[model samples]
Target: MIYDGDEVEQELCVDLYWSFRSPYSYLALHHVRALAKAYALRWNVKVVYPLAIRTPDFFKRMDHMWRPYLLIDTQRIAESLGMPFRRPVPDPIVQDPRTLLISLEQPHIHRLTRLGAEAMLRGRALELVDAVGTMLWDGSVDGWNQGDHLARAVAAAGLDLQDMETAIARDPQARDRLIETNEAELRAAGHWGVPTFVFRGEPFFGQDRVELLLWRLRQHGLQARSN
Candidate 1:
């Protein structure tokens, strides 16, 4: 491709549609943060509610093999990446322990998505999610939603938990709207999964596709950030 001398270079942007409950989303986040650091790329991070919320019947509709496969796959991927792995003790989404049926009244995930939206509004979505996701997904911490665990994580992300909580308290409807918009865009991009990265309308759906997203960016002449 030839560039005209007077033509301005367009900034490279990637849209990340992520969910807090997905282990793959957590795994992919580590790579996404590294990519942001190494390149002069704009990350449009949108935290969408997990499928458990958006499509309540999704798990019930999935193949029986999927659950076992996901358990095996996520752990192996974490091992391969040398990242600590553990399922959140109290799953973010409420469900029947024995039947694996999701409950209608969810207490945790809604709050998490609201906070994630607030972080996105503050333009520190990646930092917030990285810190919080680590706390929730990594084997290091238990009862992540208890005490100062969340407050410390928010502070680590360079955000104030009280301030964000206040924002949510003021207008939680607005945060849910933001998440809805992300979900719509994710579907419009031809996918419905978390950790999906969209570059110029093309969707790369899955943690394994991050490399392909990078390759596409390179084809568009993505540049390294200057020191």
Candidate 2:
């Protein structure tokens, strides 16, 4: 099935519930990019605040083995995908590792989320996320949010950072509400995980489920490029 944007009845859309602080999201960007570029569809990225902020006690009741196992498993997944794997510099949370008490001074996360919303509005969200997430997740760049890093990122996405900031500042409540609304919608979708892809109201959670998503897309007649 060749997907051309001409037919309204043929439109295929996917809602991507994503987070800035998720390492999986950073790793999943390439696959998302492929899906967006390979098929004719509206990629509706519904950005959400990281779980660390939304639910501070989320990790409090977890089994002691969760974090270490997650790191080991995620590292293997990154290696399998040939992606660079590293924790974000300065980390996204202001949590004390020993006590796991998250601080409220998360200056970066909120700004990034708002910028993501702005990027989505500009129709270059995946580009912005891929560019910025790479810088933050990899060791190549220092101070990922400092100086020209953000400018360079938005520029790569063909967007103006100052312009986006100005717009977001004008109505900060709307951006916050958007994140809140995405979280609600994610709950309604029956999962609260990053890198979840929703197609026709069906939820495919995890970066591992990307192949399943592509299979579903095929069933929906998603087009493949001949060249």
Q: For residue 107, what is the lDDT in candidate 2?
A: 86
Q: Highest TM-score: which candidate?
A: 1
Q: Note each model's CA RMSD in angstroms.
A: 1.6, 2.6
Every candidate's lDDT: 0.88, 0.82
| Model 2, total clashes | 0
Q: In candidate 1, how many Å is residue 44 off? A: 0.8
TM-score for predicted model 1 compared with the true structure: 0.95
TM-scores for candidates 1 onward, in order = 0.95, 0.91
> On residues 180-204, what C-alpha lDDT tens digit does candidate 2 reach at each position?
9989999899898898889878999
TM-score of predicted structure 2:
0.91
Encode model 1's per-residue lDDT on 1-227: one tens digit a residue.
Answer: 33333322666789999888999999998788789899888888899999988988887899888889999999999999989989886789998866678898988899888899999999999888899988889977788888998899999999999999998999999999999999999999999998999988999999999888888888777778876
